[model samples]
Target: MSTFFFSSSKAPSSVSSFPSFSTHSSSSPIHTFSESMMEGRIENAKPIITKWNLNSSSYTKAISVFGHNRKEAKELLKSVKDLFQAMHFLVSENSPSHKLVLAQTLMQIAMERLEHEFYQILSKHCDQLNPKSVSGQSSDESRNSDNKEASEDEDELKRAGKTITEEENVSQLAMSDLKAIAECMISSGYGKECIKIYKLIRKSIVDEGLHQLRIEQFKASRIQKMNWEVLEYMIKNWLSAVKIAVKTLFSGEKVLCDHVLSASDTIRESCFSHITEEGAMNLFRFPEFIAKGKKSQEKIFRQMELYEALTDLWPEIELIFNYDSTSAIKLQALSSQQKLGDSIQTILYEFESRIRKDLSKTPTIGGGIHPLTESAMCFICSLGDHSEILSEIFAEHPPRNSTITETNIGSSTSNHSSASPASVHLAWLIFVLLCKLDRKAEPCRKDLSLSYLFLANNLNFIIEKVRTSHLKDLFGEEWMSMHNKKLKQYALNYETVAWTKVFSSLPEKSSSPIPPDAAKECFRRFHAAFEEAYMKQTSWNVPDGKLRDELKISIAKKLVPAYREFFDTYIMMVNGDRNLEVLVRFGPAGLENYLSDLFLGTHILLSSSSSLSCSSSLGCIIR
Candidate 1:
């Protein structure tokens, strides 16, 4: 009889035509006929639902249907599954309307009870269902909670009375108590009610988690109006919040959603999308607003940071919001990344333009490094530290007006492929800086030697900046080697122009001995040449200690030996003369002492770079 009732053909046409049919009044002319047909199944099912129903006064005490009353919860789900089967049979019998009504009413009551249980468990186990816990929950561990429920699903087949729907019973176990309830409600065709309860409760948890993280949706106009300090504070909060929102809070919800609604893909996707969509859109939309804010070199670091945080979490975002309905969230995230990249690229081009068009003409006194060189190098290095994200950004907007190519970039840098876009962009920025530094060095040209010294000082400063920062990797061995060779050439040119006259005033160390009169004239010429170069080069500045020592040593190696040999050969020729002391003013020792004083920069340069240090630390933290 049970087998005949389950086939679609057995269900009477009139009952199957409508979704649900119920008539509460039991006093009907054909009530006896309906009762005889059902064989007391409806009456037996009612007591089981009413007894274990969450609202029943006996089961009250806010106890979990699945937590404290595991035995009763098992019976409740089994009874609900069985009642649904009996309803199909009642529809098939061409029974009286009252019996059909009673079966539908009993399913409604069971649905309400399950709905209550679902809400209670979600409300009670928020911590357990939180992202950190939910995502951390191993599938193996969730299976343990459903051990009893699985047996009961199998046990239904062996029951002596009416058999339940055989709709692929959950033989394998990897479901929690909540998941079991969800599957039971869903399979019985009460899934809408279960899904409604879940969406309402879980959305609040996602919203509240974002609230605690201080993430909020802000309009572009409002963000634009904010001072950079205020905007920076929000960017920092976002950096911290985006990770938790994706990895912890939303992730936890996704795992719990997938587990509970595993029985139906469409239902889980609907529920998860409805729960996380708005909050996620709000979270990702923030960076676009920030990108829309006032553009300045100062803001680029924070903007790049916002871009990177979203980029870093992209995989998790795609996995969690992996549904057509939630594609808006993914699109919003992708949109923000593009906006930030565009803004950063715009600012970078502007920065490059500024370096190219700089109008500063004032030279560093004594030809030390120009201020433009310091500021530009500092800003460019800060950008270089974010090379991973910057590469992505630069790829979309291939650095504008860029003439720098692969041979100039990080072929030798570890962790970077040859001719990477970021490497080329950084190298291009540095090349722009070098051109500007050359213009800044031009004012010292009247004294041709001072011009070379200026070029050498700025080039050395640029090299050190690259070596110390991430730019070292971007502008690889080739760039480093090229610049180092140019710096040496500049140093050599300066030595030639500055000291050629001095070297010519004395004969070579290999020159033949001369008459006393000729030797005295040589001493007089050397006196005039050496004093002039010393007076000028003494006040000149070279900030680098190693470069300063190298310059001094190079000068010493050339001048000291020649003069010492000249002085030793000619001193006796002029010793008896009364004006000898005046003519032979500097012995080789005196020349060495004065060489130490050269390039000291003491007369004109004072470094006050406290702010630059702070910015360098900021770059490290951003990277």
Candidate 2:
């Protein structure tokens, strides 16, 4: 059996005017139909809806009729002026399964309609607020021309039956609709979708006005019930954006250092502007914000976290300041230590300038020290820690005798007390480092003559550099005096150790040389000793002329007298001056000249055999 129901209205000519109809077949039970019966049933249902009444029997009948026929159900729903009216009616009377089906259908339709409306509005606003168009077309003529061009383009697009490109059709969403959609998605647990909607609308949103309104609201709410979560979210997002921007700007095959620095400056300005203006009161009331009745301490820590984030770029800055092989190449003309020192100085100066500039802008409220200052100080102070290397270079070639004996050497010590702690500390470090260098080179000193001479040269160079540079103010007269004492001691040790053998060959007292064998042996020893000393000491260099002369005089004093006594006793034994040729290997004047040439780094010139006669009995006469 089949039955039909109709409302109390004229039926369309396309349909039969029957108020109710029924069909019965052999396989079906008998069915009855009447206009009055249908009208009565509808009338009974009318009161249920009109009075906002509901019953299980009425709901069952409605679902049985409409649930099977979606087309009729939709038509009935469309006849209502308000969609919610039908929804309310259905929700109150429909079965749970029917309600679920109805809700899903409604939501699907709503989403489709909302999406169409959203895009339509977005396209309209986007065209009107086109930043590129606005920027490009300044005058009215240009604007009209652009509008005409756009119209022509649109007509051409329509003729071609092609949609506009996404690049040409940028979106600018209506905030109200955007917010509504976001709210709907949030309520439905579509958090990611809500965020997407907000992101799309962000460009169209009036940032300045919205920011002002939000700040005002935040301030008001904070006074009554603070929302630390919201504040923290805001701060974190801002810091994260800054970090991302910096990393993006600085990261590439060819990093733009100037751009990175400019971006850093911009971030610094923006952050401080917010804190000094919008966030000042809140920051000042940090204690209150973290109090029991207020927000968490995390709220107060946000600014500090931002500070740490900003200053954390120290590692990158350190890299910039680093003296790498590239820098060494640039400064290759400079000596090794000079290259290192210059690099350090350049980094220190740049870092100091940047740090001071940055810290100057930072608010010192609550006695907070800017991390920039602390970081810069640590970096500069660290340079002094390389004193070991500096000392080695400085002491590599000490001053000659002229430099150490300068009349002004003692006058400079008074100024050392006024030296800055940094300079003084560095100087002290250099001193210790030089001492260490000397110790490391001590193994070479086992060859007393050569090594002591090397020490003397190095010590002299060190003293000269200190006296000439700022080091003089750090290492005073006492330091100079001590090193000078070492220099003299080295000179003395060379003479003592090297000449012991020569001196040992001579007897303490001269015995009469009546024995020809003893005389011949003594002369042989004398000639060998004198010649060897002259040859060896000539090759060894002592840069100071005066020091060389002094050393020569000292050697002559020891050797001249002993040789004269031996010669006087030996010459009387040999006849016809045959012994004279043997006894005098070098004249006294020649010996003095040889002594003078001890550190000249030149070959000694010997007189002819005939000129080898002793001018003084104790003097050298070399063959």
Candidate 3:
């Protein structure tokens, strides 16, 4: 009941069988089937088989002529084609080794058929009678010539066919086959092989196909199925691999560390697809890139949507809420960067939309406004360009935050005209920005701080705009009163000056209360102050109206208090130093024994100096 498949180009002449290897290894007698012995039996049946075209009856007679007994001959009488086909089906379905052997057999048979066809064609082309000269010379010579020509023809055909096979390296398959094999491996649940295929696809191939392969790989590595660490590793490596791809695209070489700057513009564009938040976290750990400072950071912000995941808006508000001049300056520089500007604007837009949706869907608690919303609003305002939007959002409030103390929420709602949390954080950030602006920003100190003040002054503008009752009605009025009070106390009254003087009266101390440790701290604070003063002056010189005056006063007021406090704290710490006693007791000399070379050098120098002095004195006495 078995079937077989065969090519008509070749025919079996006898019922020949061969030995098969057993599973266990052993030295054993090898049996052989001799073609010479089959020749006689094949010739005997050829006439009858040819007449019948080797039907079942002819198969039986041919097998019997080959000297098999009745039962053995009956088994051999089965169609050869059917037997071969069945073997092929079994091998393909179950045995890789057998499949490989069958493949090789097919290739060899194809080669043999090609050789036979080439020889037949050559024989037809030749002159039969004269042989060498259109059937020339003797009969033996003509036969020899025909045989040589046929053999040469066979060799040429074999070489040509083999060349075609050799030309098809593993790489020469149509990309479709490659992709199918890769996907098949993946479907078979072989992740390692799938990754290997993906790696090869990306590196060994190019064009749009690589892009599709990468996308496939990306889908394969999604978060739900993968652990966080694995996902992180995969993304990071993908980024690095893509960078190499980018380099190959633009420059035809691998990217080196030193070459980063040269390819920065292109790499920024191409590698962005790989710049997931997870990947950015990986990049940040690279100290070399981080130290390049804001440019690199800004580039990451521009390339990836990382800020969405990282917007810890509330902590940031609390950090710069006090309007520290230094923090304000850093914030300003940050906002000014072109890339940062785009990112912050985008983040704000997304945040605003979210907040609007949330407010409509959810009601506020009695005293708690969701601080998350306020935090978002505060961050936007702090950027200093979105105040109009911020003011509008906070206008209609029983103060919209969940974390605000219940008692304070009432006071806050009543004092609407005073300044919203958003404005406060904004003002603080702006002040810090102005401070960071150094000499360049100093002239604008007044301008920058004044802008902040303007935001604060109109802080109640949101309240004035709203017409709702109760909390809403008090918005403008409450804010105006609080605003006026804050300005009088901090901005106009001698409070700033008086406070500065009081802080100044505090004792001063050496920056480094102990040797070495405080030395760096002292320099750091000094440099910070110097830079703040420098940038502020720089900013102030380019002034713009009342804003300029407002910023200058604020900066001066802030600097006096902050510096005086720094001095008071530093001095108190410094006055308690026992550094000199410690050094003189068991310090330099105690460690000198370990530094024999340094100790010797110092001794030699001192002796040389003393001898020089003695020599000079002796010479003077002689004279």
Candidate 4:
């Protein structure tokens, strides 16, 4: 009784015949009912889909359903694949869909699965069917049996009634669906799967000739919808992946390294795609990752490793060098200094290297971004600020003259002061003063002469004779071109101004218990240079207009009074901490009187800077 009821329930309707069902008899009841009935159902639906032109729309709906629920999507997608396979059977039977619905179905399923094997299979089959490949095969197989087999295979290939190009169009649509699904997987927290899918997408990119497809997708739509949660995950993990890949490269995991490197290159290209030159340089300048809990030494070591890797990235290094030489110096400084005195040693080495070797193989331009001239200048500025401490550091690590050979030539020369730390310090100061004046092109009628002379006497050469054109030539042009510039072209126009600022900023009083001998030398030379340069550079210049002359006279007349004011200020500032030993060592007998004159000179320069553009007034102020 139960069997009869089951048979009745399974029976097809016999009411006005819309379609007829074929029953397959199998030894296994389950296979007959389940596989055959389902397979037959797909076979029957294919023609209906073709007749009704619903293949495209139905497949789209299936995709949407699959996205909402993977299990349901998989089931629906599997059914679609089966349906297409059934259509292949119909094509073999010499009956095919008008739109080749089975072929379209297969294309959709292949796209949905995004299986590499499936792509490989389709590609292989497509290659065989290509006009070029088939042409020769067709000519060789002319027998009736061969003809029938060819006809059947051709029919299966054409089940969609579309040409190879049309089939490819359908396949491309499927490929797009695969991309969408991969993105969905990533969004749904299936990152490993997403990465796998991405790999497949990349392969498809090559196979399908779609360049930057993933990047375009990321830019076009996906990134905008991303919340902080998604963003944080990507940011924190993306570089870890890159680091992991880089680590593999060192560990001999060649294949893994290759894949990671490829991925990293892609990611870097995408990231920098929208960055400006400044922004990119700034990005590299900032330390991206530092090892946690490392002390200074270890931190320095780790940073050196990263710096080496970065420098090896020639393109990035070049960009950094072009964009910010200061940043490059800082990085290079850090790189060279993992060990003791490494930065200074490297600099000395570079200077020696340049002297010893012809630099034909080197880059045409260097130091433009980070010249030794600037670095040396920075040392002077540091001393100018905290001379009491910088003086100590200077003494310990005296500025080195790396020309071991040059020293022997001048060995007997009592100008050993030039090799002294004080001398080197003064040289750097002079260089910096000249550079500042040249760069700013500002007038300096101030108390700069004293400081300039202090540097000049100890530094072995006054401005013109310093072999390196780093400072002298730089300022010389400005001195000559001053007439062409905004200020009156005093021979020492900018040079004077730069020196004034330098002198004003230099340490007048010692922070330590007592001042070093260097400080006294600095003070004495400062005064002499001040008086001479001012009297010489300004006094003999061309005549000024009457108004400028009156201004200069007013300046000169007030110089005595201004000197009084400056002397009083200086006495007060130094009196609080003056060391009698240092004062006496640095002295003209009457410091009070000397201070007054210095201030008077400074006042004249400061005032005349506004009027007498020539050196005549300046010469008097200094004198």
lDDT tens readout by residue for model 3, 368-433: 122443454344333334333333333421222234332322344423456554454333332232
Best by lDDT, which number? 1
What lDDT score is found at residue 368 in candidate 4? 14
lDDT of 4 by residue, 247-282 (tens): 321111222112222323333222222222232223
Off by over 4 Å in 2: 1-423, 436-446, 510-516, 574-583, 605-623
Task: Count clashing residue pairs per candidate.
Answer: 1, 14, 55, 15
Worst 10 residues of 2 by lDDT: 10-19
Whole-model lDDT, model 1: 0.75
The C-alpha TM-scores of every prediction are 0.81, 0.34, 0.22, 0.23
Q: Per-residue lDDT tens digits of candidate 2, residues 1-623?
A: 01111111211111121112233353432124233333333333332233211122444323322224423322322322123333333333332434334433333333322333333344345323333322222223221231122245345445433443444332211222232333332233232322333234322332332343332223333544646666566555545543433343212101211111122333222322222222222221222222223322223234334434434543542333233322332122123223323333333334434433442332222112224323433332343343333333234323111222223333233244443434433443334334443453455555666656665655565565566655654556766787788778977877887798788776667343346767667667767787787777776666656566777788889887777677656654442345565455664455666677677666664444643434455433444
Give the distance in Å from residue 518's predicted Cα in candidate 1 to where it truly belongs: 3.8
RMSD of each: 12.5, 24.3, 28.8, 24.3
After superposition, candidate 4 runs with Cα above 4 Å error? 1-41, 44-73, 87-596, 599-623
Residue-level error in angstroms, candidate 2, position 27: 98
Which residue pairs come into collision in candidate 1? 131-252
lDDT of residue 107 for candidate 4 = 34
Displacement of residue 287 (Cα, Å) in model 2 is 36
Clashes of 4: 15
Which run of 10 residues does model 4 get worst, by summed lDDT?
Answer: 361-370
How would you encode candidate 1's per-residue C-alpha lDDT over 1-623 as one tens digit per residue?
21232232322123233345354344643344544545466767788777655445644525556665666777788777666656655655455657667777677667666766777777766655532322235533543334355466446435512432222111111135678888888777767767877898889888998999998767887887888888899999989999988988888778778777877878989999999998999999999998887789999988888888888899999988888999999999999999898899899989989888888887898889888889998988888888888888888877676555445432453235665677777777877788778888788789989999999999999899999998887777767898899999999999999999999999755546778898899989987887788878878989999999999999999899998888767776676787655666656776787788898765422112211111333221100
